[model samples]
Target chain A: MLDKTLIGRESESTLVEVERGAIRRLADAVGDANPVHTDEAAARSAGFASLAAPLTFPGVLAQNERFRHSLDLGTRSLLLGEASIEYGRPIVAGDRLTVKTKVADVQERAGTSGATDVLILETEGRGAEGEFVFRTRETYILRRG
Target chain B: MLLARQLYFEAVKVGDELPPLVKPPVDRSQVARFCGATGDYGPLHVDEPFARNAGFPSVLVPGMLAMGFLGELVTDWLRGARVRRFGARFVKIVWPGDVVTVRGRVADRRFEAGGRYAVDIEVWGENQRGELVVRGAVTAQLFYSGDDETRQRGGQPPLVVTPAEEEERLAKLSRSTAPARPAVGTRPAAAPAKVQPAKPAAVPQKGAPPVPVQAKVPPRPEPKPVAKPAPKAPVKKAPAKKAPAPKSVPKKAAPKTKAGKRR
Candidate 1:
């Protein structure tokens, strides 16, 4: 069972740089083929410094060390049931971001098989200039062993 | 050739449907490529054995992949429209061999601060079996040909300044460099402004960036381009903070868990 007390726990903010290569890889992975997210000149003409980060890019920041340690989900079967991200602006390559995540709620609900733990986590990302850039909310379902 | 056409708020109707973005059937190689691209090498996404051991029949496609399809659908229609906010909810598992099609409709339209307008689209994805796999909405700021020079900002339009004559435009711009809080999740105006039909002869050349289709509109009286210089100041702020980013890259290079590996 997930520790109920873990609710409301927050993690230390971690800083990450948005890399151009990483943005290109994400564009390729998604099969977007949008030049704005892959080619620098295309991005420049589109009004971005480097390649623009995909809409889902900020979710990767949740994998930071502080969030993992704070969740204390140790070896548990965790499934990413759902995720949603709200962007303040398009995140471009060469931008620095600070990510801080926290467990918003934890609850045990009865399932068809048995009891399951549902943890709601919210991650907020801010640009280096201290402006809110994006926020992602994810729901993780813990497998009942 | 199809991607070169620009979609403007003045031309699109509320019920107009966007062209569907259909993706090839998912496969293992594609999964591996996605993993390498996002740096999310989750065992469940890359290793069949790991996924089978975890009770899944085979490696599963990441939800983000479906989200990407939705992104492509909107941006393709938008052409150069700026995406201010996008949100999605993953509803089902998309496995290899499942072809996904993204569909969208112009849900709402509204006038915003600068001369630009906003288009709200309801977008979603489904598999070949017709199962709804993901649903979301997007708020994008796009330029219209009718916009006067006093408010030439394209994507990031300033907030709606309550008219008090001269105080209307200048006061809002001077108050905050930050964009007005995004009007997310809210429906734009019910009755849209007048929309003009697009010209048929505006087809663009192959592979070249799609030009905004609204370029064919008749020219109007020119006003001072006030919002033109706003974007440059914010672009310079990012590079200053970029110097320390490379130094921290090595520290975050590897996976935190045994099951999660960097490609």
Candidate 2:
């Protein structure tokens, strides 16, 4: 069973810098041949001041140690059931964001095989000027015997 | 840079389908690159021996990588549209050498209170065997043609569609042979160039902003091309088996679950 008391537990805040190389690497890995992600001139032509990050680039930020440790999952068997992101603004290269995470909810559901614990976590990123950049929500299924 | 035609809110219809993005087979190298990019170095994704020990035939592809593929499909289709929300539910494990195709359709359109126009899109990705790997939805904000910076602020009233009009539209769609739009995966003859630059729009500097840049259409590398035409028929029949009950469970947890049962 999941610790219901951890529902509102928050992680220590951390600073993350959006790097151009990281954006390009993700774009290339996904086979997205978009030049705007690599070329500043092309990005400026489209309207951005610098190279623009892909829509799902914030997934990298969610991997911060501070956020992961907050859950205290501790090497248990788990599977990602669902993942989502809500964007407050378009993130670009050279942007600095302060990120924090928290456990949103926990529930138990019975399946044919057995009962499972559903854990929902939310992480938010704010720009240097204190503007909202993005928020990511993930759902994990912990199977029990 | 060549300018591509922008997808304005006025041009979008209720039932339009996006051009399908068919990716090449998933390979270990690409999976490694993704692991390095996201810092998610799980053994189930990178270690073949460990994956086999975990009951998976081979290393599995990360769900975020598939989500990225779906994101590319939507952004590639809607030239200047800004994605407000994007999400997915993992239905099955995607194995190496499995070709993934991402597709989506416009489910609904509405005008918001802040003079914003938004569209709700239903998107999903499937493997070569016609099994759903990921299913999700996206909400995107768009601009009308000739929408200058001033009109983007709060001024225009909401555009409401009555129930009768909606019913009539659905009825007409059901009666048509091709429905309100063309079928999925059928590329139009006059489709825009794949690498065109995005058109410049009047963007607001603060608050929720417009999509500044658009991705060029995919020029995916085909290392080893499979029989391309074999999967199309199976894709249309995939939705009939939508329950995804036990088949969709991630294989990584199989070994541990059995161990727990033995105890």
Candidate 3:
């Protein structure tokens, strides 16, 4: 089981920025053909200052990949289970994002199989405006290695 | 917002493959453009001035770039299908000079769609280092020709494709909209020329900031001799052989042939 003391602990910040070609390429890959994603003119017509990808686009920025090491996965014994995201608004291109992930909960249980610790990580994706665009809840399970 | 209503049940099979994509490597220019378009000007992205003080040798690519890449991987392979749901963990940091590949294999098929097929697939990405960068799993609905009356209307697209029978439809559509891509792969995507400067995406805008002097661009390269049309691999330029930073606009056309065997 993970140390209960590790709960509510935060990891270093990782950031990322949005790129246009990649957005266009992603649009192409999905065959979305959405002008709002590829054509700046279409973007202006729709009211955005420039072409921006969908709200889910924020899922890409690591605050621009500033994260050098991850403390969560490096721990002595753990199993990454699942991850999910709930958004506030769309992440546009040119947006710089910073991610501050924290271990939110820790619980241990012993079943017929064995014993394990379920660790939940809460990551808040912030932009320059300090707006928290996304609040993600990720769960990890730690058992004897 | 509800971007697009995707596939129904009855169309997916266990072995279908989504269209494949090669994500361009991470580099300096890609970082700059991404920051510009998204308006994400966090100093960590482009401010080398501060990034140095904050602790790092240079700028890095965002994890969002990889997420966008995964979204594209699913959308492209469906060839017009919509991605109703998907998710991933940014397993590794992507940087310049690394080759990236994305592939999705149909994993299951469900029939909850009144008659349509709710196709499920697992998407994955890998880098030149043989590292798993992002793993995405998505569910989409496909049209198999007997299912619906609306499939003809581009079937309420994730972004309606106009469903032409041939690639020529898209080729013809390009004639009037986007400028013809000039370099293709012949001009090394990132290889910058010592004397001749290339076009920058920001040039069209008047008040754009002058490109930082420290920005490095790959040297302009000689074309490969292979005669075959370049593979569908994106024009992500190779950054080796040059210490220059990535330029703001290094978009190159598709190469004539596969650039040496991509790992």
Candidate 4:
């Protein structure tokens, strides 16, 4: 089994500034026709300060390499087994955010195909004002070597 | 505000089912668009031959894209329901022509701390062939409208969408937006541009931040045309002319594809 001591270990924090174009691209990418995600006026009408991010927009921030290496999952044949995100509030363009990730849990189990390591990663995002914005938990299945 | 109606916690029953959301079929453009938006160009999603080499018949949709679909499903259903928690696991690879259907039901409801009422939902997505592609649960806070206790506690109702209002909004939006997209693989004049050029990755070298200047000059778009010729196996006039760059890049950038093919 892979080293279990990595559990509770934290990765180097990553900081990202939310951009309007990035928000629009993400919305268009998903084929979501929601105007609030692409148009500032529509977002204002919807009671947001600017084009609010789609619920899953934070996934972009989670795509950093440090988090993957925190669990030493960079080289493993891994599949995203489960993902969960809890939002404290809507994210908007120009919101500078910081994400800190930690290896939450690890367990070994036998599946139909073979033995695997289920690695759980927990990421917490905070806005520029240092208030919590969202938290994401992703479970990756690592095929045992 | 955006929702014409407000969905109150009191009106939701534990067994209530949501209206099914059917998305346009997965297409190459959509896949390419997602890659540009998220900056995830994991070859398996965009490179057709690479995908086939990896044992998939064609390009596979990113698992996160399916989760995004489910997120859209929830927001469209609840109008403005605050998604407190959302999760899903991909069950199967979604291909280019699959029409995805998102189905869900209210699993449970409870009043949480701070006077927030939360609803637990069971959601699943299926393909045109009725194969399950993803399944998961979502927990959202449904504002309890018309509750004196909530109002006294300074709580406000969340926006909820009605079928009629949603239909009208979508119709109006559709008219204002560009024409509907054509079916996948039936190429239209507006196939999305080739996937964005690879950003000079930010790999730290010897604890020093790689200079950002190199990334400013975008890679040429011409590489796409050349790369397509070598992979298809049928349309080879002469391999010598087009064989230099694409072959080199694919061998280096997409080692997994090559390794998979070798196995």
Candidate 4 overall lDDT versus native: 0.61
Best candidate, lDDT = 2
Question: Model 3: per-residue lDDT, tens digit, B150-180?
Answer: 5445544232222242236446656877833
Per-residue lDDT of B38-105 in model 2, one digit per residue for the tens? Answer: 88776778989866665557787888888988888887776546778887776667777766767676
Provide interface RMSD per model, one decimal: 9.8, 5.6, 12.5, 9.4
RMSD of each: 16.6, 13.7, 16.7, 17.6
- Find the candidate with the highest DockQ and give its number: 2
Q: Give me the runs in candidate 2 sitting further than 4 Å from their true place.
A: A143-145, B1-4, B147-263
DockQ for model 4 equals 0.33
DockQ of 3: 0.09
Per-residue accuracy of model 4 over B3-88 as CA lDDT, tens digit each: 33445565666656665566767777889999788876766778888655644466767778888887776665565556777777
- Write the residue-wise lDDT of candidate 4 on A1-145 in tens digits: 7679989888888788999999989887887777778878877655567888888887787775645645555444455656778788888998989988888998886554455678787888998889999988877666433
Ranked by lDDT, top first: 2, 4, 1, 3
Residues B79-141, candidate 1: write the lDDT tens digits: 666777776655556777666766676766666665546677777665554445565677787
lDDT (Cα, tens digit) per residue for candidate 2, span A1-145: 7889989888888898899999899998988876678888877655556777887788888776556565676655355677889898778899999988888998776654566688888889999889998999887766342
Top-TM-score candidate index = 2
Q: What is the TM-score of chain A, computed separately for every candidate?
A: 0.90, 0.90, 0.63, 0.91
Off by over 4 Å in 1: B1-6, B112-116, B144-150, B153-263
Candidate 1 per-residue lDDT, tens place, A13-107, comes to 87888888888777777777888888887776665567878777876666654455557776555556666677777889988999888888898
10 residues in a row with least lDDT, candidate 4 chain A: A69-78
